[model samples]
Target: MKKSLRFTKISVLLVAAISMSLTACGSTGPKGGAAPVQAGDESKLFGLSKTETPDELYEKAKKEGKVVVYSPSARANDAKKTFEAKYPGITVEVFKLKSNDLMDKLIKEQDAGLFNADVIITKEVSGAVGEEMVKPGRVYKYLPEDIAPNVDEPFRTKDGYANYLEMRTLYYNTEAYKSAPVSSWWDLTTPEWTGKVYLVDPLSSPAFMDLFTGMVVNSDDMKKAYKDKFGKEIELHGTENAGYEFIKRLRENKPVVLKGSGDVLDAIGKAGTKSQAVGVAVSGDERKIEDDGLKVAPIYDIKPKTSVPDAGYVYMAQKAPHEYAGKLFIRWMMGEKDGKGAGVEPFNELGSWVPRSDVKSKNAIPYEKLNMWTYEAKGFYTNSAKVRDFWIKLK
Candidate 1:
């Protein structure tokens, strides 16, 4: 009865929110191109119209007066400080949430027609809730058009509403498995590496979840190849029974699940050369792992265990109280370094792919550009609920 009542309340809330957003005006339109401000020209940025420059859109960002963000990373505070320091007048509110929570909140808010957030930096929840929400291109668009062009095609929308930027890379402790032949992502699932494997819970870490989702969705070729090699069908998607059996076997591999990527990183850090657990890690954390003198390397094998590109994106709420601020934030996000985030090089990071080409890549894997892996974007986004339920059943 309690569960039923709770559900009823949630339904009421959702209905109220959706009605609010639908009534808001100009919430679902696109913006025209801004005049190009070459890198290093802050003057043009100051005088341009909101149509031409993110700066013009948010000339009062400092006065309007706060920017709220929801991110999958625990480092939200650090990122906020970096941005606030660069733009002194604007106060930043940061929420470090699991990807699931990020998606739940975003979707619920969108459904309710509330625009409480100015910007959102999330992990790969795009798979789970992307389809239920607004189309990224129809609602929010890309920034720094020239620069964004260099980001990988898979990471962004063709219309440029969503732009995927590099955030981090995955790393394994090299010294821990020095004697063993461990060079690829598939190696972690092997018997020899069984007890030694550690990973983040998919519900908690968007980066790790997206990475794994990428693996599952991209394993189509492998499934076909397995069937071809054995001269029989390798059932990747079969009746419910077959899928459940596969998932059960996957769980039997006995991965040590932590709440977040940082937990795995902590264990790696403490272990030094003697670390027994090898884990999936953020590129930034991996650099720290290596810098601490522990031998760690990023596994970038493109076949079988092909890596997925890490990307960042933002969306505008359909019913935003601060609609102008939300659009301004998206434009600001796309602005070159001089415009946003403390010259953090605007959208390019290590081991990830952005749309632009000339900008230096931080941690992109070679041969990754090859479409050897069959990544199902549509499948992941639409079927995430089923996948999450399955993962829970296995647990």
Candidate 2:
């Protein structure tokens, strides 16, 4: 639901290679432009909390009084309240911003030699999170040993584990249609939906941009979906593959392009709108159906996939002032050993899916059963610019 970008694959790999070489496995890099954290010697900055019990970390972190958090979701405030209620003496302060802004602020803080944030939960998987923050040693991955196993493998990463998986996919007005109107990605290119589909410009959103790049990388799936829909092999016109060709035909249909998910939803989600409009939206925003009284629902089984699944990730800050508090908060936020912690309750809403396999969502729909695919981060990181340009220059 959050982030911004423009990058390429070979360039991303090359830069990562150079950064790794310079940092010597992230042991020798500038700690956000402060002191160098020697590879094996970061224990002082790393703290002893990783190996300690939650009770031990909680006791130590309680003494610190508070932990600072930077996150893209507003729900962190709910977590903050529940956490305070559970722990009493300890407190959480949340800084809510878009992922791009959050990452920029973190980088700037590190560059300025100030390390104030104790924890961060945001998303920019292919761009700022992996390549910009984790690889540069600006953040650290902290998985509570007791709870890690409950998380699905797809949600785990070397950088850190995701707190929740979010879908960048299709949403339609329920008031306009009784059921899903489009059954495939290729359906959007058809004449029936011309000028009736709404999309957030990929150039403005990393999630949408990466979703397109993912299509290019896995264009075979797009080709197959195309043929299955139209009963003929697809033809590409000055494009890389069926992915670009899909974009071409969809663009020719004159879809309305907006600036954000909220805007796109607002355009199509109103009641009594005669137009049978579909919008590409963040699934997490599906809550608007209740919150704003918009009758929108996700098309969870769109052929070839429902969406490019991304996530909201939680990461510990490097040299955090309240390291123990940071670790304890992460443990709590991950829903503890059994996935019943109050800290995760606020996030167990209808639109989002938690990473913990043991945690059942409050809503009925199981995202695991939906048609979703794991996107390629390396390709998303680098080749997204190609997708962006294609959109920009498409006639």
Candidate 3:
């Protein structure tokens, strides 16, 4: 009887060992899935969909009651009023900020696990946005089924929807020059335009960083434009590439770094102001020509691309309290069914380009005819810090 019992114990031990070995051989992963390191399935939380109609979301959102947003647009208040008007029960609480400030606040809130915002609509500081938010599963993408067809494929990122387009553009004083005094980007680096060029602080402004980082990423284009302008290959100094070289030279020449866009405009746009000053981007446009009596005009014809495509993107918060309401607000803000939705009317202004093909820009420049590079998050992410360091060390 003792021997039989010992054999039974041995048999059970052998079976258990075999089962453990088989389990190890069958799985190479910790959780034993094909995609082990990817972000978890957040679709259930975000409720992402193309087919989910406004009516469907509205029913759920009405129950959810209110939506909160963090956006950079001055017109966000107008959008809030319009959205509240459209949906009787749903109220909007708006937190307007510049792109950088918005990112900072969102990151702080996310770090503290304070998920108060339902939506975030900021101008694209693509690299920072992707690195800080999207990759961490802090935000999720959803474009409405009704509006998806009209938006171009490139604008529809897996991370978010590009709702509109703006630029990292250069402007020349019409009061100073009969036409653009400088024809190429390199022209700003030369002695002739030195002290005449005005710019916002690159270190502080996300938009300027986007521009400088873009120039670095498209260094090849900068080289080509340099050769076109100078009729020789670009001679890189301590800088690594033509883009960096251009930035260094522009800095050496002392582009008057100002505190605000209004300051740059006042320098370049005041009527009969004969400074011949060219200003780096700060969001002023030719509508100033009509309304503010400023004579600034965009340099659309400059080489190495017309402008950096600084897109305005809308994203749903990953852990939103009012998920349905958030999605509803994004759809409404994206100019709803016909691109004639009331939510977009507030944002329709000169220099801003809507993503929907049907929605026309108030700017006079032909969209297709303009040459500009698409916003590249990875490229900017890879090099923005290096560019920032270079800018600071030089400064």
Task: List, residue by residue over 42-112, the lDDT tens digit for candidate 2.
Answer: 33233212355778878888889999999988888988887888787888999998888888888788779
TM-score of each: 0.65, 0.85, 0.83
Best by lDDT: 2
Q: What is the C-alpha lDDT profile of model 3 across 1-395, one tens digit per residue? A: 11111223354446435432121011111122111122443332222354667889899899989998999886778888989998999999999987767887876787797878888887766376754555445565666556766765465434456676667677877767788777788988888877988888877666677788888899999999999998999999988998999899988998899986667777888887776788876543445556788888877777878777777778776567787888788888888878988888766677777766778778676455557877766577667778878988997
- Ten-residue region with minimum lDDT total, candidate 3: 21-30
RMSD of candidates 1 onward, in order: 8.1, 4.6, 12.8
Candidate 1 lDDT over residue span 43-117, tens digit each: 232212224344654675645777677776544465455556656666667677665576677656755756566
Pairs in clash, predicted candidate 3: none
lDDT of 2: 0.75
Cα misplacement distance, residue 242 of candidate 3 (Å): 0.9
Point out the higher-scoring one by TM-score: 1 or 3.
Answer: 3
* True-vs-predicted CA distance for residue 64, candidate 2, Å: 2.5
Q: Candidates ranked by lDDT, best first?
A: 2, 3, 1
At residue 243, give the lDDT of candidate 3.
90
